[model samples]
Target: MTKTFVIDGKTIPFEDGQTIMQAASAAGVYITHLCHNPQFTPHGSCKLCTVNVNGRNCSACTFPASEGQNVTNISKELNEDREKITQMLFVEGNHFCPSCEKTGNCQLQAVAYHLNMTDNHFPHFFENREVDASHPDVMIDHNRCIFCTLCVRASEQVDGKNVFAISGRGIDKRLVVNSPSGLLKDSALDVSDCAAHICPTGAILIKRTGYSVPIGQRIYDHAHIDAVALASEGEAHDH
Candidate 1:
């Protein structure tokens, strides 16, 4: 017998150590999130995955799912809150989707679409951030960084490089390279580094691979992020 929890009336089974977001994703139940990746430790920074657990709001990515616990994931008020969080991400950075290389493949844009966000509700920050293209094979467009720290974790944990880190605090916070000069060229990051590929936004990108996939044939263009995982699993099984 498996232990289970109720999320939006859906009974989701989970192992002892699984969080609500983990159990939900494993069950093919999509709970909205941004700063979450199965390969990395749950940061729960994005608050987009916030859900009502036992009548109180908690981050589903980090909240443990107990047997018989009632979790409210999708609802009118929750979706509205999610929409605001998504909007804040947009305004906090210069996320100009039209001209961005990660447009269709971007998780931020995809999640915005998932939340039915038609406009940026908050005022744009338009903060002038530097774009570091000094690295031969990679580029860092700080303008699009959502501060998810996926790259920071990937570099430190997987690549064992500790090549990326976040600096400052709150509105003044920004990504920094691990180098004496604080430049990508001074760091040891390679194109094959997991950190190079983990960014969910256009903040980090391969140098010469822009627009490699046609806009119409991009990942999100063909399927929503919620279905992409399951669809990819199906394709892998076919192979």
Candidate 2:
């Protein structure tokens, strides 16, 4: 039997194990999110997908959908809060969009545009992070990492290689390479691994592929993220 839930006045159906995010995406409802990929285990690390579930906030990605549940996903208050969170992501990282190679195709930038974020609402961290160019075919620009952990999960789950891990805690947290020398060159990651291409930001990039599609012709250039997601990655189901 299919369980149904109400989200922003729309009815969505889900299988027994499906999450709210999975169901909403299947039902063609666009929710603001950052750290969610249907291919990975729902980490619920990014709070952008938090929704009011019967007066309590829950992450849609990890929260299982229950029958007859009322989920407040989209609202003026919600969008405003989400916008602020997106702003903090911008300032906390050195995400100078103009200088970023993933400007047009970046999910963070697309989510910012979707939420109508205009200015950096908080003070910039300006912390100097490393740019790991030690790898022969891949580069790690730590300044652009949002700590989404897609790469870490993809490395372990998809590529069968434990090449990345998150270390430290809170503001001191950062992505670390799994190698004796703590560098990508010494790791087992290959250019063809799914982990290498799973980064949503410019943090992990293939060498010599910058601006190949040009600025105005990139993936998110001509389409809203929601539409693009639907067309390219519609109705995500577990494999």
Candidate 3:
């Protein structure tokens, strides 16, 4: 059955139980979002798609639409909030896109561009992180991780292997392999494992295909976050 709700000043009908993000994507009211792969479960850690639902800053990826509910995806308040979040992602880690392999195609970079973030307002954490190159097909750089948990969830849900898990306290939390060996290659992960392909950063790069796609053909090659946001709007119109 379909339910009626308000989104960005428009009253629209959506299927009951569908997430606000799904509903917005269906309606083409695009919000600047990353860390949400429709192919997998929503990991609202990015905070890029935070929308005001009945005055709460809830993530669209996980929030269900309700009858007569008001959902605001883009507003000054939300834009500022998301911008700060984007800034945090930049400074909290080392996101030097110019030197990284995933520069043009990264979702984190795209969202930053969409939010018009040219400089990080916060102090850089500059934490010392390690890279795991033990896996034959993939590399894991802990420094680039924003703790989105996409890889951890993907491993369990899509790859059918529970090889990744989160460990540690607050700011020091890290992704750990579920093996005594600790190394990714020693962790018994295959090339086809979701852990090899689900990362949004250069952190978990595939070993051999590093330069397969040229700079221009990358996912965000010609598009900025603003362009993506606009494209989402156009896509909504197609529905």
Query: Which segments of model 3 are wrong by more than 4 Å?
Result: 225-239
Query: Between 2 and 3, whose lDDT is larger?
Result: 2
lDDT of each: 0.90, 0.89, 0.80
Task: Please give the TM-score that candidate 2 achieves against the real structure.
Answer: 0.97
Clash pairs detected, candidate 2: none
List runs of model 2 lying over 4 Å from the truth.
none
Candidate 1 stretches greater than 4 Å from native: 230-239
- Largest TM-score belongs to which candidate? 2
Residue range 141-236, candidate 3, lDDT tens digits: 777888888888888888888888889867878989877889887776788777778787777888888779988788787766556655654454
Model 2 has a clash total of 0
As a whole number from 0 to 100, the lDDT of residue 236 in candidate 2 is 52
lDDT of 1 by residue, 1-239 (tens): 99999999999989999899888887778888889887778899999999999999999989998999999999999999999999999999999998999989999999999889999988888999999999999999999998898999999889999999889999999999999899998999999999999999999999889888989889898688789855543343234
Backbone clashes for every candidate come to: 0, 0, 3
Q: Across residues 99-148, which tens digit of lDDT does each residue of candidate 2 receive?
A: 98888999999988888788988989999999999999999999999899
Question: What's the lDDT for residue 60 in model 1?
Answer: 96
Q: Model 3, 120: alpha-carbon shift in Å?
A: 0.8
Error of 1 at 170 (Å): 0.8
Best by lDDT: 1
lDDT of 1: 0.90
My TM-score estimates for the predictions, one after another, are 0.95, 0.97, 0.89
Model 3 root-mean-square deviation: 3.0
